[model samples]
Target chain A: MEQIGLSHIAITTGILLILTGLWGILTQKNIIKMIIGFSLFDTGIHIVMVGVGYVEGKTAPILDEAVQLKEAARQIVDPLPQAMVLTAIVIGIGITALMLAYALRLYQKNKTLDIQKFNDLKW
Target chain B: MIIKIIAIIIGLAILLMALIAVYNKKLIVAIVAAGVVSLFASVMYLLLSAPDVAMTEAAIGSGLSTIIFFYVVNKIRKNRKDHA
Candidate 1:
């Protein structure tokens, strides 16, 4: 693994985001906060994947004869993460929407957003 | 080096926002802080060169979620007042 500089930074940030998410989940009393924590955790992992694909001193994948397109392609950032992130993005949206719908239903039934006040599901 | 510094700042911002969301007395402030953290995370995603993830984070993570939470909060508040 050729790790240095920016890559190290990316890795550290990813770890930090995960830690923050964990803290949020553990400490927050509200359902919405938990959702936010989950999202943040998801985003952090996605960022780490993107960072893993980074190529030092590489331009984005764009074809142009004016520049050294072939050379650039040789050192180009990984396209797999780009593609994967697209999939993740859509999945995140779907999940968030579904979670919000559930939250709404929970609120409607309980009349409270506080998770502590919600004990009907706890059996 | 600069990018790493930026990433560290973004991470700190995320931590700060998460704290605010967890500890803020006002529900609205917490909600807004969550939105800000999502927005900051999206910016970090862009910095890490994930534009697609950044866009989705901005839209779904910050936008739709915040609005939904606000609506839910408003409903809860109104219902409580109705009982009082």
Candidate 2:
């Protein structure tokens, strides 16, 4: 059997977190709770990205005096996922803020955070 | 060897905290629990040799996001108080 490594552990944790967050989003009645779930989901995705990019026995993507240019690619983990996750994190925060703003507006209209209270769409 | 063990523990802790965030009865506790999950995930990122991601997660997840969540919660509570 292969030994456990950082990637294995991170990937597992990320997937579990995604599941937990999905449960929160699906079952939660409060809008705030759903927003929390969204945050969890976002974090989980980022973790997975970093995990997938991780290379065994590699240092961080940054190039410093310790590593030579020719060996930099072999010495460091992939930088692509890190870059993607960085952008995603910013977008996630923006989306979260937008959701919270919407929640506040909805609460103002109905004086309730409960999703069931706004039933205008019902026929 | 030791890093793997630490990762396992961190993973378990994140899972438990996430469950609490999802299932807990109290809103404040749930929010705090979610913040802890972010902090742990950041640590996990560091273990994965993604220091850049780890720093961003630590700053945004544990700091900015928590503050935003708390602000929203406080606003809702204050509004509720006014309505009642």
Candidate 3:
């Protein structure tokens, strides 16, 4: 059997987190719970993105006195995914905030947070 | 070597908290559990050699997002009490 590594552990956690989020999103009747599920989903995706960029024994992308400039590329893990995850984290929070605000507005409109009651598109 | 074990432990903790966030009966408890998941995930990112991502997840995911969720929850509660 292959020994588990950091990437393996991280990606596994990400996948499980995504599954948990999906379960919550599907089974919960409350809008707030659904929003929390979405947040979980976003976090899972971020974790997976960062995990995929890991090198076996490399350091982080940031350069410091410990890392030589000429050998930086060989010494550091992939930076593109890290940069992408940075943007994703910010966007995830923005999306979460927007979702919460929309849920509040929906509750205001009907005074109910139940998913089944807002079935305007049910035909 | 030992870092791998630590990573595994943290991963399990994150998964457990995520399950709690999904399956808990109390809304506030669920929200706090989700915040814990984010914090643990930031640690996972650090282990994966993504410090920048780790910092961002810590600050934005666990910090600001939890506050916003709590704010919205409080607002909803106030709305319910106002009507009741």
Candidate 4:
């Protein structure tokens, strides 16, 4: 009971984070604010991924003295999600940077940050 | 037991800060609050036993992203001042 509760708490937190980020993205008017919201969403997803991969009594996936070779397969927590998250984090940074660059260029072109004002594509 | 409590507390803090970041009237305040959310999230990552993810979140999400945001804000402010 206790063990299940721990992971449950973490997973719930992740869901809350995602909801907050989504709310920000939907309601905010500024481009930069939307970017910040996107980052938050990315972080929330990563947290959930890590939370889902967690094991109750297992250690990290590092092979060492405490986690011997033969028992490692059973004793170690899942490593695949962690590896994917690392890549995702870096990609998140790149995407944020790219979005910021777009914001800068848009500001230079239109001299405004309000999303409604830049509706050239709107029909 | 204690660890669970701590995680819950931190998670609540993250949610609160995120709300502040999204709804604050001041853009700078919103940006800073977002940075705080990222910092707390890195701590949550640590609790989840992904030291590598924690480190990445701390460095990229909290630190570099905030710096980039501030830089862009400053640039826009300076441009507006010059034009005004």
Candidate 5:
């Protein structure tokens, strides 16, 4: 019961982070604010993924003195999520850089940060 | 037990900072607050037993991203001043 409760705490926090990021993305009008929101959203998803992979009272997946190869399957937390998150974090940085470049270009063209002002694509 | 409580507090701080980053009228304040949010989230990742993620978040999310933002903002301001 205690183990489950503790794990739930992590998961709940991840969910809350996700909600906060979503709110930022939805409400903010500035392009830079929107980029910040996107980064938060990416971080939130990574947290949730890592939180879900955590097993109560388990060590990291590294095989060492504390955690042996024989008991690794049972004793180590899931490594797949951690691996995926590693890739995701790098990819998130790349995507954010791209978004910021776009924001810079937009600002250069329009001389404003307001998203509503970028109406060239709007029909 | 205590770690879990600390994690929760950090999570709440991240949320509050995210809100401030998004809703603040001043762009510079919002950008700085957003970087703080990423920094705290990296700490939360550590508490969640994701040291690699924490490092990456700190380096890329908090460090590089904020620097890039400030650089772009500076360029934009310079361009505006030149235009004016």
Candidate 6:
């Protein structure tokens, strides 16, 4: 039984990455680490979506009648995930870039990157 | 059964890496390990048949984020040695 195919591995890895990212966010004292955690979390979700598209031995979803369309479709991998991952990849980059800019600004304001050290604004 | 075992091993390794990222004292090490964790996750994505995700993971997770982190650390550390 090939029950444990690629999706199983991808989903498991994605979940693990999210959990690890959460753990990092909760335990780390640095803002940069927290950002890193966030990135990991984002990666986890993206992978999950992409993994959902995988069909064992399926060809890329494209218009092709040379190879019986119906049977080909039976084995064709979903195209939706590719589109979703494309969107997600761009979004992830945007968020990371923004977060890095924020980190830089925060460092400028506080002169340190330690989250614990920035308690002046907290009532 | 064999594929299941392989998946289990990969999952366990990811868990271990997560733990190390959370518990490691050095910030640099944690960031690097986090990148590795993402890189490994990308490979797992490939295993799961998501080449698109695998490509994204390789690019953003391991590539862009790591560079941004290195810059953030260097920028901050240059001024504050104690925090470094």
When sorted by DockQ, best at the front, the candidate numbers are 3, 2, 4, 5, 1, 6
Please state the CAPRI-style docking class of candidate 6.
acceptable
Tell me which of candidates 4 and 5 scores higher on lDDT.
4
Clashing residue pairs for model 2: none
Total clashes in model 4, counting residue pairs 3 or more apart in sequence or in different chains: 0
Q: Once model 1 is optimally superposed onto the true structure by TM-score, how far is the C-alpha of residue A2 displaced, in angstroms? A: 13
Candidate 2: fraction of native contacts reproduced: 0.70
Candidate 1 per-residue lDDT, tens place, B1-84, comes to 677678778878887887777678787898898788879878876776666667887888789878877886787778779977
Top DockQ prediction, candidate number: 3
Error of 4 at B32 (Å): 1.6
Candidate 5 chain A, poorest ten consecutive residues by summed lDDT: A1-10
How are the candidates ranked when ordered by lDDT, highest leading? 3, 2, 4, 5, 6, 1
TM-score of each: 0.82, 0.96, 0.97, 0.95, 0.92, 0.82
What does DockQ give for each predicted structure?
A: 0.52, 0.82, 0.90, 0.76, 0.67, 0.47
Docking class of 4: medium
RMSD of 2: 1.2
Q: Write the per-residue lDDT of candidate 5 for residues A1-123, one digit (tens) a residue.
A: 355444576677678777877888888888888888888788788888988988876877778798877878998778888889989989988898898899888888888989888888999
Off by over 4 Å in 3: none
- Model 1 stretches with alpha carbons more than 4 Å out: A1-4, A64-67, A121-123
Question: RMSD per prediction, one decimal?
Answer: 3.0, 1.2, 1.1, 1.4, 1.8, 3.1
Query: For residues B1-84, could you state the per-residue lDDT of candidate 4 as single tens digits?
Result: 777888889989998998898889888999999899989988987887778888998999889989999998899889889888
Tell me which of candidates 1 and 3 scores higher on TM-score: 3
Report clashes for each candidate as comma-separated counts: 0, 0, 0, 0, 0, 1
User: Residues A1-123, candidate 3, lDDT per residue (tens digit)?
Assistant: 147778998899999999899999999999999999999999999888888999888998778997899999899999999999899899888888998989999999999999999988999
Measured on C-alpha atoms, candidate 4 has an lDDT of 0.87
What value does the lDDT take at residue A44 in candidate 5?
A: 82
The TM-scores of chain A alone, one per candidate, are: 0.84, 0.96, 0.95, 0.94, 0.94, 0.86
True contacts kept of 5: 0.62
**Candidate 2, residues A1-123: lDDT per residue as tens digits?**
147778988998999899989999999999989989989998898998899989987998888886789999789999999999988888888898899889988988889989878799988
List the lowest-lDDT window of 10 residues for candidate 1 chain B. Answer: B45-54
Compose the digit string of candidate 4's lDDT tens values, residues A3-60. Answer: 5555677788888888889988999999989988898888889888988998866777
Compute the interface RMSD for each candidate structure: 2.3, 0.8, 0.6, 1.1, 1.5, 2.4
